[model samples]
Target: MGDQFPPDVIYEIFSRLPIKSLARFRCVCKSWLKYINHPYLQTIHRFKEEPTPIIFQLVPSANSNKNSKLCKISVLRVNQLGTITIEKDHVLDVPYKGWSHQTPVLGSCNGLTLVLYEKTPWHGTLLTLINPVTKQRHDLPPVKLRDTEWDCPSSLQAAGIGFDDSTNTLTTVFVLCKESFWSPAGINPPLCTMVHRLGMSSWREMPQTPALPICDEGVFAHGRLHWLSNSDGFHSANDGRKVVWFDVKMEEFGLTDAPKGGQYGQLVDLNGEVGFAYKDDGIHIELWVLKREEWVLRCRFDLDRPRHIDVVVCGCWNDDGDILLTSNGGKKRLFVYTLKTDDLKEVKLDGRCEAYIRMHRSSLFSIRGQNYK
Candidate 1:
C-alpha cells in the first residue's frame, strides 16, 4: 500500500471510535470533514462489531423541590475485563414545563434521544433531540394532528426514536390513544400515529396504524422498534396479541409471537439481539432471547436471593455480555451481572431516583440527519 492509509483501514478506525470523539475530529480539517456526510460512513459505523453502552437518567426524589428542572444522566459501561464503571455522569437542566416527572424518553438512536415534554393536564407536548455525550441539542417543532393531544387528554402515548437505514435518517414516532379531538365536522378521537423525520420541521400523521396502545415507549433492536401490545395474553406468541414492531426503514408494522410463558416481561436489547426479562417466580427472573426469529432461553437470575433482593433489570451492558439491574423501589442502586460467570457487581447511586435507559451507539457524526455537526 502507498504511504496514504487505505480508505478501508481508515473506515475501520473511525467506526470503532465513540461518536463523541468523531464529532470533535470532524472539525480538524475540510478533507476529514468530507467523510462525515459520506453515505457509506453510516453503514460502517452501524454494522461494525462493537458493544453499546447503557445510559441511565436519574431524577430528583419526590421529597426534593419539584421546581428544579435539573436531572442527572449517567453512562454505564462494562470493560472487556468485566469491570463495570461509570463512563460519565452529569447534570442536565431540562427547560420545559412539568419535565420533572412523566418525562417521555422516546428511545435513543444514533446516540441521540428524542424527549417529549408535556404540559400538565397533558397539553402542548413538544419534542427535543439531545445527544447527552456531544451536548448538542435540537428542539423539534410542535406536532399536530386532526386532534392534537391537547384536544383529547389521555394517559396513553407510544413514542420512540429509530434509525431509517434506507434514507440514512433518524425518525421520531408518537401515537396518542383513546382521546377525542375536534375535526371540522365533529369531535373524534382518531388513531393518531405521528412521525417526524430527523430533518423535517413538521410531524406527519400515519393512518391505518393499529389503534391499540403500546405498553412501553418501545425498544430498538433488529433494525426495528418493538413493544408489547396492550392486549391480554399468557406468555405465548401464538396468542396473536404477542409483539408489535415498527420498521423504521420500511415505515411498516409487523407482528410476531412473544416468548412462551412470558409474563410481566419488559422488552430489551440484549447485545444486538431482541430479548426480554420476566419474573419466573418470587425468587427468579427468566430472560429470553430471539435469534433467527426464534425464541431461545437465554438465562435466569435470582431476584429474591439475599444478594439480589428487590432487584429489577434496567437494561443490558452488552459489551461484557452482562445485564444491568437496579435494586430497591426507588432505584437506589445498580448492579451488573454476568450471564456466563454468574458474577454480580453493585454500583452505588448517591440518592434514590427514577431510572431510564438508552443505548449508546457511535453515530455522533450525524444528529437529526444533519451533517454539519
Candidate 2:
C-alpha cells in the first residue's frame, strides 16, 4: 500500500509535517531521505498550493535578558475561524544564551535569517546568516574596501542577506564607511561601500554609488538587494529618493527613482512582486507595487485610532500571500495582513516578550520553489 501512494502524494503529506518531525523521519530509510532531497520535490514544497500566514516577533526592550529568553520563535497556521495553531516553536532547542539586547534580526529569506550583532569593542560588528529551523549558521567575514584609507568602525558597519536562485548562492552585502566623522564641520568626507559575496570570500568596492548621502534600510527582493538612498536634493529640493538595487547575479548596482512624494518605508517581496511601503502624513501607510516596470500604489493600511501609533512593517510574503507587520506604541501587537481579503488580524502570542520571527521549511519536502531548486 505504501507503494500505491505515489511519491508526489507522500511528499505532499511530508511537507506538512513540522521540522522536528522531519528530522526524526529522515532516519526512516535511505529511500525516504533520497525522496525528500529530490530537487523536484523541493520545488513543489516551496511554492505552496495555498497561501499561509506566519508570525513576526518584535522585541520592544532589548536590554531585558529575561524578556529575550522568553521570546518564542514559532510558526502558527491561521484557519478560517481566525484561530492560530502552532506548528513549530524553535526556542525549545535553539539557545539564546549570550544574545545582547541591541542586536536586531534584519529579516529572513529562503529559510535563512540575517542577524546583526550589536557593536562591541572586541567584536566590531558581525552579521550571522542562520537557519533557526535547521539549526545551521554561517558567519560572513568582514567587508574590505580598496584604495581607501579607513579604519573599520564597529558602529558604521551595515550588512544584509539575499538569495540568488539563478546561481544557487546566498549573497551577503556589507557596507563600510571611511571613518567616523571626527572633523567639527562634518565636511565632505571620503566614504565607500563594499560588498562581500558569501561563497567568493572577497570584497568588491562600489565606486559609482555616491558617498554624500547614506542609506537608511535595505531588503532583498526580485533577484536583487535594494536600499533606500537620498540623491541630490532629495529632502531639500524634491521628495524624490532613489531606490538603489544591486543585481546579485550580475554583480551590478543601479538606481531607479521612486514615485513622486513617495518616501521610502520598507522594501519587501509581496506575492512574487517587488513592493515598497511609503508613509503618508505619519498616519496612514501605503504599499506600492511594481507592475510592468511602473510603481503603483496598490493598497493602503490606515491607522485610524489615536492609539494606533508607531507602526512598523516587516516580513514579506511567505509561500502564501500573507504579510506580517509588528505594530506597537502604547501596547504591543503582531498583525497578519492578507492580500486577498485586505484584512488585518492580530495574532495572540505567548508572552509580552520581544521576539524575532522567521519562516523555515519544517520538512525537506518543503524545499520546493526555493533557491535550492
- Top-lDDT candidate index: 1
lDDT of 2 at 160: 60
Candidate 1 similarity to native, TM-score: 0.80
Off by over 4 Å in 2: 1-35, 38-41, 49-103, 142-157, 181-191, 198-217, 230-239, 315-323, 328-331, 338-347, 355-373
Task: Kindly list the per-residue Cα lDDT of model 2 for residues 1-373, writing each as its tens digit.
Answer: 2477987788788777655566566668877776665655655666443323333343334555553322234555544445642343443122232244333555555666666543333444455555555555565554444344445443243446666776556676665566652323435344556665556555566665443444534566678767666443434435466677777777777777776677646665565456787677776778887765579987787555354466666545455456676664334566677777877766665546354443333324222233321
What is candidate 2's local distance difference test score? 0.56
Candidate 2: worst-modelled 10 consecutive residues by lDDT: 364-373
Which residue pairs come into collision in candidate 2?
42-367, 42-368, 43-368, 43-369, 46-368, 51-320
Question: Per-residue lDDT of 1-373 in model 1, one digit per residue for the tens?
Answer: 1137877777767777766677788778765666655767767776343445444453444545565343355555444445444544553544543444454566776667776654444334567777776677788867654434454334345777787767777788777653543233322334567788877767877765743446667777767888876654322344544677888877788787778667457777666567777776767778888777778887876653565566666566665567877664454567777878986767654444466655555464356456432
lDDT of each: 0.63, 0.56
